[model samples]
Target: MIGMFATSKAGHDKDTVYIIVQEDTEYVYLADGKYKDTEHPKKKNKKHIQIIKKESDDILKEKLIKKQPIYNEEIRKAIGGIVCQKQM
Candidate 1:
């Protein structure tokens, strides 16, 4: 589920939105591009996050799917857009 947005449901980061950078059987690596960048994603249990099914930035999606090198700024901006849209 790379590139998908998920909100932490538990732990200290509860309510924080993160991008799914990678996933495994029991866990998903998340990044916000601010504190948790691609280079250092936060590992969390799949059950602890609520995934956002709605599609977000296409360019970010493409980059994540292609295993491309992405910058933190791009991720931040993309997430900012999503949050803004949700509030409107």
Candidate 2:
């Protein structure tokens, strides 16, 4: 609810890292490598993806502290950071 990082728990993007750009009652908007940016986020069922709220908070804070716009590459970086942390 407060983070941007997530992984596709199901569907075509399964196990793929994504940044949650938007969310609604039944769906959540996601972005990744193949996905362009938050401007064109992918809408998927909430149940279809796993949320990674903890790791993304740092990146989110960095973005806010730097006052940068939410861009596609930033999303990838945020997701990538989480993935890298998980692997270590």
Candidate 3:
């Protein structure tokens, strides 16, 4: 789902967190806002990622669903919040 957070379950990026920017039947495009920014998202197998949040932050979820412009800083901030929560 758009704007959902996920962690890589397989591959070299295993355990790496990312935001789901786009998805199809087979693959999902992900971004960390660092190595994988919105403009150049990494495409990975849908089954290879573990979903973190399906009901995500309202702002980011709305923006992604509406196809509005979003910046890397925003993505990084959003993801940081989630990761922090998980660590706590």
Candidate 4:
């Protein structure tokens, strides 16, 4: 489960932004503001979800790559600090 944050200029409402939730290695797009409980049918785990603003595939990929290390570190720390943890 990972949460991705992005900014999009093509939004209809200035106060609203799209959110993409990547759960179980699947990406789900949520474009109904930020408080709505959008349905993601393509998700596999249903539990692992991500939230991000809607954007082009290239932009999304760029953001994901930029934040991948950060997200990975967070996940490692969350999972008993085993994946990237250093032995002491």
Model 2, span 1-88: residue lDDT tens: 4345778888766888877666679998776745546567788888888877565666664663464666666667777777888899
Model 3 misplaced regions, further than 4 Å: none
Top candidate by TM-score: 3
Candidate 2 C-alpha error for residue 14, in Å? 0.6
Give lDDT: candidate 2, residue 27. 90
What TM-score against the true fold does each predicted structure earn?
Answer: 0.92, 0.75, 0.94, 0.25
Weakest 10 consecutive residues, lDDT, candidate 4?
75-84
- Candidate 2 vs candidate 3, lDDT winner: 3
lDDT of 3 at 78: 86
Candidate-wise lDDT, in order = 0.89, 0.69, 0.90, 0.33
Those runs of model 2 whose alpha carbons end farther than 4 Å from true positions after fitting are 53-55, 58-68
Predicted candidate 3 versus true structure: per-residue lDDT over 1-88, tens digit per residue: 8889999999999999999988888999999999999999999998899998544688998998898998999999988988888888
- Choose 2 or 4, whichever is better by lDDT: 2
Which candidate wins on lDDT? 3
Off by over 4 Å in 4: 14-18, 23-28, 31-35, 40-88
- TM value for model 4: 0.25
- Give lDDT for model 4: 0.33
Model 3 — TM-score against the truth?
0.94
